[model samples]
Target: MQEIKATMAGSVWKILFKEGEQVGANEDVVILESMKMEIPIATEKAGTVKEIKVAEGDFVNEGDVIVVVA
Candidate 1:
């Protein structure tokens, strides 16, 4: 399993994949809003999305796990 973590503190703006969906390496899984900028968080591995750890509008800190892929 691989954990996709938030790269910076922000509010989750969108979730790009659903649980059990197949994802490619470096695919954007979530979009986060901070300081009026949108930052896309991507997975480093190609795998099925096993979990979504945050919802839209949820606040997250840097290093927080946002999704799990396996």
Candidate 2:
């Protein structure tokens, strides 16, 4: 399993994949909004999305797990 973590403190703005969906390496899985900028978070490897640890409008800190792929 691989954990896709947030790169910076922000509010979750969007989720690009659903649980159990297949994802490619470096695919953007989530988008976060911080300081009025959108930041996309991507998975480092190809895998099935096992979990989404956050929801739109949720606040997260840097390094917080946002998605899990396996």
| 1-56 per-residue lDDT for model 2 (tens digits) | 99999999999999999999999999999999999999999989999999999999
Residue-wise lDDT of candidate 1 within 8-66, one digit each (tens)? 99999999999999999999999999999999999898999999999999999999999
Stretches of candidate 2 above 4 Å error? none
User: What TM-score number comes out for model 2?
Assistant: 0.98
Q: Model 2 misses residue 54 by how many Å?
A: 0.6
Per-candidate TM-scores read: 0.98, 0.98
Give each model's whole-structure lDDT. Answer: 0.96, 0.96
Instruction: Write out the backbone clash pairs for model 1.
Output: none
